[model samples]
Target: MINVIIVPAFQDNYLWLFHRQGSDAAYAVDPGEAAPIEQALRKHRLQLAGILITHHHADHIGGVNALLQQRDIPVYGPLSSKIPAVSRPLADGDLLTLDGGEISFRVLAVPGHTLEHIAYFNPDEHLLFCGDTLFAAGCGRMFEGNPVQMQNSLQKLADLPADTTVYCAHEYTLANLKFALQVEQNNPALLARQQEAQRLRAANQPTVPSRLSLELATNPFLRVTQRAVIEAASAYNGRPVDSPAEVFAALRRWKDNF
Candidate 1:
């Protein structure tokens, strides 16, 4: 089995380390800084096999150069010239096979948080390492892509199996759930999730890798078509929204200030 461990960095970023049981080599995804990652590697005593880049954000690729000094590993990222650290430039439909196919991933171009953003998914494992494109109870801001683009990108992720374990890049669940409650107060599943998330955070635990099923029920960004979300977005924008993408834009703006 592939063991996924959380390596926290830069206040909220979650640098994930994936390795199989009894394995000495592993992969690091979005290592924002080298210090904490180095510490984690030493503590776990695993060798860095490769690096996975999701976007060109500094917080995601800041430590690439530093980490390269320790071990020269193939850095896989989107087919964008912006990220020079990526040795293997990949795009949607590409497959990444590591350890002679012991671990494999299907690349998905999930642009929204950035125009070049991408995600990795293992169908057999039901695991999704979606960078900043998706969050537990929310979605990323439209930095370079439009509302329609982001909505469509989210749809791609939502189309995955209900049991898909989403490993997003940040620990924003509690904060996002607070805003989610404001959007859909009557959502019982969201309320229960909030309580559980609160209990987890109260004990200094990480509230991540949430089930896609739970996110489908609680995430307002993914529920723009729902009656409550539509009503809330309409009210917040002081106008009526005609389409799901329009509602999504309204909710994103509302959350920016919320």
Candidate 2:
């Protein structure tokens, strides 16, 4: 059994610490800073065995060198010149073994937020550590890849099982949900989700790792084919949305200013 610990970082970033239930060996995912990760390791009495980088963003790979200074562990990340300390440069379909085969993840190239952004997917575990490609009721802004590429990447993720738990790298659920509700005002699922998210935030709790099932039903970005979402996106764009990618682009741009 693997226990995933959420380490809150600068502003809303979430640095994931994955470890076996009864073992000391652990892997850090997208650790933006060293201090929080170091503190978590000491608090849990865990060993830093490896690190997983999802992208080359400063907020995601900033702590790599500092953590390496503490312990020289293998860094598994995309093959990008921007990200340093990547001893194991990975690509799509690459199988990553960590903790002596105790845990395995399949690399998926999900470019949208960044050109070389990747996700670690464990089919057996039904988990996806997607950096910024897929969020809870939201998707990342297109920084490097175009709308078509981002839509395709999101489609790949949407094809996964509905039970897959998405561990996004940020705590943008509430803000995303606010925009989602605007796109789907009459959707009971979105309204209910808004209520639930409000409760979680009121308690100062994290609302991440949302199941794909819930997101499929409520997330506007994933529901481009749906009539309501298409209508909303079309209205917002002041034009007809002929394709899923176009709808996704309209919605993304709408969210940018929302």
Scored by TM-score, the top model is 2
Predicted structure 1: lDDT: 0.92
For model 1, what is the error of residue 226's alpha carbon versus the real structure, in angstroms, after optimal superposition? 1.1
Over 173-200, each residue of candidate 2 has an lDDT whose tens digit, in order, gives: 9999999989999999999998998999
TM-score of 1: 0.97
lDDT of each: 0.92, 0.92
> Which runs in model 2 stand beyond 4 Å of their true positions?
none
TM-scores for candidates 1 onward, in order: 0.97, 0.98
Q: For each candidate in turn, give its C-alpha RMSD to the true structure in angstroms.
A: 1.0, 0.8
In angstroms, the error of model 1 at 37 is: 1.6
Instruction: Give lDDT: candidate 1, residue 28.
Output: 90
**Candidate 1 weakest lDDT stretch, 10 residues:** 32-41
**Clash pairs (backbone) in predicted model 1:** none
lDDT of candidate model 2 versus the reference:
0.92
Per residue, candidate 1 scores C-alpha lDDT tens digits across 1-258 of: 789989999889999999888887889998889888888888999889999999999999998899999687999999788889999998999999886688989999987789999999988788999999999999888899989889999999999999999999999999999999999989999999999999999999999989999999999998988999999999999999959889999999999999
Q: Top lDDT: which candidate number?
A: 2
